[model samples]
Target chain A: MDFIRQVLDRVGDKWSLLVIAALEAGPLRYTDLQRHVPGISQRMLTLTVRQLQQDGLVTRTAYAEVPPRVEYALTSLGRSLHHIVTSLITWVADHHGQIREHRAHTATRP
Target chain B: MDFIRQVLDRVGDKWSLLVIAALEAGPLRYTDLQRHVPGISQRMLTLTVRQLQQDGLVTRTAYAEVPPRVEYALTSLGRSLHHIVTSLITWVADHHGQIREHRAHTATRP
Candidate 1:
């Protein structure tokens, strides 16, 4: 149950899911992840990536160089998560407009 | 893209996913959703449910009965979400242990 809770929490988190989703195309550097996921702050990006790394869903690699370089990528585990989240995304796109109109009509009634 | 972001945000939220996951069994009242999801406060539950309802992921029904009665359930939309979330849960359970140990081992060495 705890495991389910954490997974739900991780997947449920705004930053983490977008981070995972962002990496679907391929590996990205820290800057790339930030740019790819809009509305994400530097702090949130760092925190979420660390959380993902700890969860073993993301792997971070650092390159020893003059300018300093770091990259983040999905492990196989992360890639698998994409399939799950993608399905949810597809479901939402399929249904959200109707749901919104229903709520709008219901709210105006009283 | 906004739809994807909102859907991601909704799913990424802690309370909403659990609330949706809990409802997989059947419909429940507001209080019932609270009980099913441990650690959820009434505020978050109400908020998350409203968000889900707005997103068309959850359907709320009110009965004109003495003392007032209401029940919430997944629209076909919500049920479709169950399929998506279940796959995520499965992925977590399948991999969490190994991931935890990997983090632990790496943590101590560096």
Candidate 2:
């Protein structure tokens, strides 16, 4: 439970979800992931990717190229989460109206 | 994207996940939710539930009674997320070994 709770805390962050989803397409360098996930800072992406790597959701690879090329991609576990992550976004888009109404209903109840 | 992103940020927290899971059994009052989720502060639960209520993941109903009885239960959308949340937990439990190994492998590579 502790381990799982830790991961939920790690990935449930908005940046982590978007960052992982951004990499689902294929390997991305740090810069690429930064660009793909709009509004993420270099600092935040570095931190989130490091955390995801610790949690085993992302893999960071360093190439032996002269300029020190590096790339990030989803591990199998990370890719597996694509469905749920995407589902979450899909659910939100589809139900924004219902969600809004639900909130409004609750706000007035008190 | 904006709305969904906001919710993931709201709920990806450890407290929110556990609180929602705690309420899966049935309606819980504010106190009930707090007790069920260990390590939660009184103030955090109040804030989290208010957010969950705003996002429609939780519904709070108050009975017109002497003590101001209130109960919270998962909305339909909230119930739908049980599988996903449970999946996240199950994934962690099932994969803790793999996850640890993956992290170890990455950490030493640098």
Candidate 3:
């Protein structure tokens, strides 16, 4: 249970989910990922990617080229997580309005 | 997008997920919830419940009995979130070993 909680803690964070989702289509260079996931600062994107790689959810590869190229891709574990998080993102998108209405109603209660 | 992120931030925390899962069968009192979710400090349970109530995910009802009774149950929105989070929990449980192995492999690398 503790292990499960730890995994959830890693994957459930906002930036991590966004970064993982951005890499769902395929491997991406750092700049590509930054562009794909709007509103993520470069520092946050860096930290999120490093964390994901450490947790074994993402793979980072660096090329031996002139300018140097690094790409991030989801491992199989990451793909599984992506499937689960996509459902969550979809649920939030679908019900956010209702949740907002409930919050409004709750706030007005004295 | 920001709104969705905020909602995820509320529900994605460890204690909140545990509390919500504990309420899945039915409404539970504070003590009952504490017992249902092992290792949860009273302070964390209180905070999680309050946040859930504020977000309109969990509903809290207080009774004017001799000792005063309060019960928490999932609202429709909470139920929706529970459905999504359950999938995540299941995925984590299923793949935790693989993830552990990956972490071990990564650690041994230079």
Candidate 4:
């Protein structure tokens, strides 16, 4: 259970999930990843991608080119977790309206 | 997209997910909820439950009795979100070992 909680602490974070989801399309440069997951700050994006790489859910590659390009991509494990991330996003999209209605209703209550 | 991010910020929180999962079996009093989701501070649990209630994902029922019993249970919306929570838990359980291995390997890199 502790191990599960530890892992949850890592991946259950919205930033981590968003970063993982952003890498689903293919490899992305750090800037591309930033654009894909809007509102993520530079520090948080760097930290999130680094953590994902350390967790083996993502990989970071650097090419020894003149410009030295770097890209991040999902490992098989990350891809496996993508469905859950997709479902999470889908769930919010599906229910945010009802949730908003409920919040409004609750606010008007005594 | 902004709405989705806002909802994700709420429900994607680890505390919110843990509290939601803890309430899966049935209604639970505040103290019972604390016990079920280990390591949660009183303040965080209170806040999480309140947010869930306001979002219409949870219901708080107060029974007029000697002790004035209050219980929290998942609304259908919360229940609908339960499977995603379960999947998140299962994903961690399934892959924590690999994650740990990767972390260890990364630590040893030059």
Sorted into a CAPRI-style docking class, model 1 comes out as medium
TM-score of 1: 0.81
TM-score of chain B of 4: 0.95
True lDDT of residue B81, candidate 4 = 100
Per-prediction CA RMSD (Å): 2.8, 2.8, 1.6, 1.6
Residue-by-residue lDDT tens digits, candidate 2, A1-110: 56666666776677987887788789999888888988887898889999888878888899999999999999898887777776655555677777778777867876
| Deviation in Å, model 2, residue B72 alpha carbon | 0.9
In order of listing, the candidates' clash counts read 3, 0, 0, 0
Candidate 3 scores an iRMS of 1.5
Q: lDDT per residue, candidate 3, A2-29, as tens digits?
A: 8878887878887887788888899999
Stronger candidate by DockQ (3 vs 4) = 4
lDDT of 2 by residue, B15-107 (tens): 777877888899988887788887788988888888888878888899999979999999887887776666655556677777778777878
> Between candidates 1 and 4, which one is better according to lDDT?
4
For model 2, what is the alpha-carbon lDDT of residue A35?
A: 86
Off by over 4 Å in 4: none
A90 in model 2: Cα distance from truth in Å?
A: 2.3
Q: Give TM-scores of the second chain, every candidate.
A: 0.85, 0.79, 0.91, 0.95
Model 3 lDDT vs. the true structure? 0.84
Q: Highest DockQ: give the candidate number.
A: 4
Distance from true location, Cα of B94 in model 1, Å: 3.2
State in Å the error of residue A12, model 3: 1.1
**How displaced is residue B62 in candidate 3, in Å?**
1.3
Task: Return the lDDT, model 1, position B85.
Answer: 72
